[model samples]
Target: MKKTNILKNGALGALVLSVTFGCASTQQEEPAAAPAAKKDTACQAELAAAEAARKKAASVGGEWRDTGKILKSAKKALAAGDVAECIKLANKARRQGEMGYAQALEQRDNDVNSYTVERGDNLWNISGKDSIYGDPYQWPLIYKANRSQIKDADLIYPGQDLSIDRAVTSAAVNAAVQHAKTRGAWALGVVEESDKAYLAR
Candidate 1:
């Protein structure tokens, strides 16, 4: 009778131990899965943000090579399950893309040619110079551009600053020349003279 009682107690203890270990194993697995899922979500969010920034930069003619490399590295880190490293690299790529876009905008606006004034630089000589209009007749165009600085069309001093407008078409040039000829003839009291006689001088 005693042996029977001992056997029953030993069986009950074994059953309780098995149940407790099973519950512990299940709890441990649940915690591990939850953390992994959370990590995946974080990584995906970072990757999406980085991609958006890169596309915006590209649309503005930004340099994307370095950003592209950083993004690739981020993807590699993500695949390796290095969620922290992946997020860091992705953020870095995003900043690079933004900077590249800004630089592109600045360069676009800075695409202009500039020149400084020098001694012996009159409107006529400045326009005729090879670096400028390459035609002395284009002086009227220069005068029209610098109207605020030059009050007299006949006079321009050396060492003065001038802005050149290269958008002068041939038609505009001819019109300017005709206007100058008419004004000059009118000033000399020769409005009745032939156009050839007035322009010959």
Candidate 2:
């Protein structure tokens, strides 16, 4: 029994000694991180562009609520030498400004629902007007609305009255804009196949 106890105690002492020595050893120093790249003037042009776009949207009474606030933060970020954050905020502000301008144009005369065609007014030109849809490609909506009187989508008489659609859901509006963007080709007097496909949809 004395021999067994001595062996066990000897083994425990060896383990404790190994653990203490292992913990007492000095650790290696970690490698230092590389310095960040300098970008002093990188976001200057972007900051100018964002400010201009925000002003343009405000001129049209369409400035979004957060656009100015974001631009201010972007300017602060630039002053702080955070080039990436400044550029990102500037880009977001510019896009909001553009969208706000479009919204203001689309809502220009929501009270009036119909347009009397002028001598030089075609579906494309009319739809492109700020008081109308603000996008020429959205002429299809006008065409669809007045199909009972319009035979050729390209031909419209001066005195014809055309109706504007404002009650469409966001999905339908997006679909119309998408179709206008992707339609293949067009002709003057005849209806386009792409138009037909869009109308069918």
Candidate 3:
């Protein structure tokens, strides 16, 4: 029995010593950290600036340059005596004109007459007195109006007593005397020269 108790005590002591030394000699390791995520933040900022510049360039090119080109073409056509072509260019230049190209276009065709043929009357005398006609070539319109009485568009003689009633009106009578006093036939309305008196009432 003494021998068996001595062996058991020796084994228990060995087991306790092994456990204590193992605990004291053990080392702790640090945990692994996750890698930081990669980002394209600079690329995102560059893309935003490029898009804004593209839009601004498009707006400037489409508005001013395009409109100015059309107006320039219209002025060229007018100088070339292509009245109809000039009018078309003017319409395209509409966006650029501050006061409106449209109003000026509307007035271009409106020619007003101030006198009708009379006995021994000719294009020279008629155009001479009328400022709107400016030249004898425009006499065709006057001749057209009096075609029935004049017999021919080109051949009009004096004392024919043709209708000046078209150009003559109470307003003209007033203007003739008024201008004599004013030194110029200003303050006269073009509508009064074309006199739609019957329509006015």
Write down the TM-score of every candidate: 0.51, 0.46, 0.26
**Candidates ranked by TM-score, best first?**
1, 2, 3
How far out, in Å, is residue 29 in model 3? 50
lDDT of 3 by residue, 1-201 (tens): 999999999999999999887776652221221111111232233333433333333332222345556655666765675556666666545434422333333333343434545776674456444433444433433534454665433366655644332333334334433432343232322322222321222
Q: Which of the predicted structures, 1 or 3, would earn the higher lDDT when compared with the native? A: 1
User: Per the 3 Å backbone cut-off, how many clashing residue pairs does candidate 1 have?
Assistant: 0
The TM-score obtained by model 1 is 0.51
Give the candidates in order of lDDT, highest first.
Answer: 2, 1, 3
The clash number for model 3 is: 7
Better of 1 and 2 by TM-score: 1
Clashing pairs in 1: none
Q: For residues 1-201, could you state the per-residue lDDT of candidate 1 as single tens digits?
A: 999999999999999999999999998889888877898788888888888888776765564778888889999998999989998998898888788778756654563333456775666677677666556766766767776776655556666777776544446666556654555432222233333342333
Selected candidate, larger lDDT, 2 vs 3: 2
Report residue 21 deviation for candidate 2 (angstroms).
33
Best by lDDT: 2
